[model samples]
Target: MQSIKLRIGINHCLTDNNDLRYNGETLSDGFVQHTLWKYANWIPVCLEIETDHIHQTLGCQSEHINDLSKKYLDGFILTSNSPRHDSFRPKVGLSKGGTSASNDMGVFARSLSLKYPALPIEENDRLHDPLIRENFLERIFTSKRWNIAFSNSFTPHALIQFHSSHKFLFMSHSVSLYQEMGRLVARSGLLTLTELKDRYVVLMSSSLKQMATPNKHTNVMQHIMGFLKGLIDADEKKEIVETIDQYRTGQVPWIVPITLLNLHLRKNSAADWVLNQTYLNPYPAELMLRNIV
Candidate 1:
């Protein structure tokens, strides 16, 4: 059972008040629901600024960002033309930064990314790309795992345990990073927990940025399937292999092959390690991240 609430902050500068009413796409809602599974409830936090109240109590750009981040864990920002004024505009090169207009609406999008570098941020425009969307969700789920695993303690044992669970996930992304992460964890006795965490997270995120291709995923999936070589008969093993091959060819979704492996896991106790490997179930089944790619 899960108790913590999962949140994704949405920061956007609305050109009109109608944007505040509703845009009417429940994909975000469903995505959260599926990713969190049924273990916990969902409370979606969104910040829409139609006008920047630089003089207003909550309209200050810094406060607006602080307040929004306080409520949500991660977020998306929508880009649009916004009226620019000196009061809220930076004297420095605002346009040169690749940020939008000088107004709060335009600039806050860039602020969110800068403020939360570890956050999985996607712009309203770029998120339309399948690859970008998948990457965002994958990073968000990784952030979720970090939140859960590191919430309580950062002892050496805890670090090792967390690393153990995620090794396969790292391997699927980058075997080199996997080995490097393991080496760092092995040195927990020599380094402070804080240092260990900081270094490990940077490397973890870097590795995941490599993008999990079909071949990489198939390799991890098969590696997991291999654990039960003798337990499953020729026919059953062949079925799983063919299913994974189909996924490699893009004939079926990742969920199909993974679910098949899970069934085998349930049938055999010898494959207990497969259950702990994050590669098998990194996020909730409902997310269907595997379904698309």
Candidate 2:
């Protein structure tokens, strides 16, 4: 049998100890020496660090930002800080030859495109073919920008939503804002997992939830329960429970990854199961489906 060629990107904070484990190993455990071997099948993308000195006091340097972008990411998801609702809108360049927000994004996109033509650039706002123009009209009329920065920041729930349709997922390293935006994008359906199962899958960063939070001992159980309660039905619930049991038994090492779970939820098979399960309050399920649709 051929090995599955799926590229899964995880965006995370390098500083977070939990995030280090998702890369199949820890940073302290020979991250530098065994970098490729540790992340053998995954593409580790780092996120640009946003600090008080860089964003506030000294102002951001375009070269510094560009250099970071070049070194870490092939693509980026512009967003706001998580845990704290920091604004996604940055001042752009430094006191010297700094760029504006739009200009900076354009420069980054252009630079990435020029360097790696294979990677496609995607942001919250709609842009022209080359993705240079900010499309002020859409920005003014729609709330994609607002959703990008604040609501539904990066969570496994959000990634499940995103990979519901797209085959490949890309994540950055920085945790504050980009991951939050990635969550929103995944939820909003801007980034979807393609149904083409044969396509190559690529993930930029490592899995944040699995890495940052311990699998067996974390709040993820609560969150997963909430998500399952909100969606799963009697028959599907039985199946999911069985699957979870198998996961616990080590029969299935990775119980359906959250990405697949969300995709299953969106599919007709799970949808039918959901409709059949009568005990669940239909209102919340209805609302959730409506939001996704």
Candidate 3:
């Protein structure tokens, strides 16, 4: 059997001390790097160090470049915000002397190309196409849309559609999670008195019937309430009921359908998910919706 080989690249600010948090790098950089390293076995390809003093500190030479590329050149991950980095080109022509930051990335790209001509270079932004972004939010949030434009080389038409349709561009996970719960309510079918009680009982029970309940009609609201009731020894089920009753009070977006779908499907694991379903089908959307009714 042929072993599956993967080329993983790290795009981060390599400081003298390898602190994962509370450094000069953006929070998103830390989050993205942490998630990737935690889930996948990626060999360090090209470390796009975000720094002004790259030439003097890192000692960028042809021999050193060849050594690193020969050892781990599969792809390159660009970290800095796209606008900040791209804007520098206009202010200071595409020369090495104008801006230290722009020059650093240019130098790194050129050196990698010179040393390893055949290796494929990829960035984090390239992996997060618009479809991937929508899919990611879909599973996690019941009702929210991610509209923010990513600062990477990869851009698809679907991503533009998401940005145009949504009200906000950026949102935190906590907010997104609540919005997702709201979506579960809106999208769920109306249940009669007996049906609602039966659904509630199934959600509360640990039997196979409960587990078999499809996520679409699982009555997450009641489940959440039951869980909470157990914690405080109160009528937790009432809390869930009350929350659902007050659902109209909260602001929910129409695009959350996309976000919720993406979240449940786990879009970040697209590559792994694709490999797992090689015998079944290659279409991600089809595989994702297989269980959804």
Task: Compare the candidates by lDDT and give the number of the best one.
Answer: 1
lDDT of 3 by residue, 240-271 (tens): 34444443233222122333323323433333
Clashing pairs in 1: 9-74
Ranking by TM-score: 1, 3, 2
Cα distance off (Å), candidate 3, residue 34: 5.7
How do these models rank on lDDT, best leading? 1, 3, 2
> For candidate 1, lDDT tens digit of each residue in 1-293?
12444455543222222244223322232333243334333332344333544234335557756776655463343432222211122333347667764334244555655676556655444555566667766676777777777676677887788788887788888999899999998888898778988888788878877788889989988788878878999999899999999999999987899888888888787555668787777666655667777
Local distance difference test values of all predictions, in order: 0.64, 0.32, 0.33
Per-candidate TM equals: 0.73, 0.23, 0.31
Identify the runs in model 2 with alpha carbons over 4 angstroms from their true place: 1-222, 228-231, 255-260, 268-293
lDDT by residue for model 2 (1-293), tens: 01212121222332234543322442322221232123123334333334332335223334434554433332333222221111223334445556443322333334444453323233322222211212121111112221232244544454444343221111212234335444444454433344221121223122221222123312332234345564566887676666555544545533243333555455634444332321122112211211211
Error of 2 at 176 (Å): 14
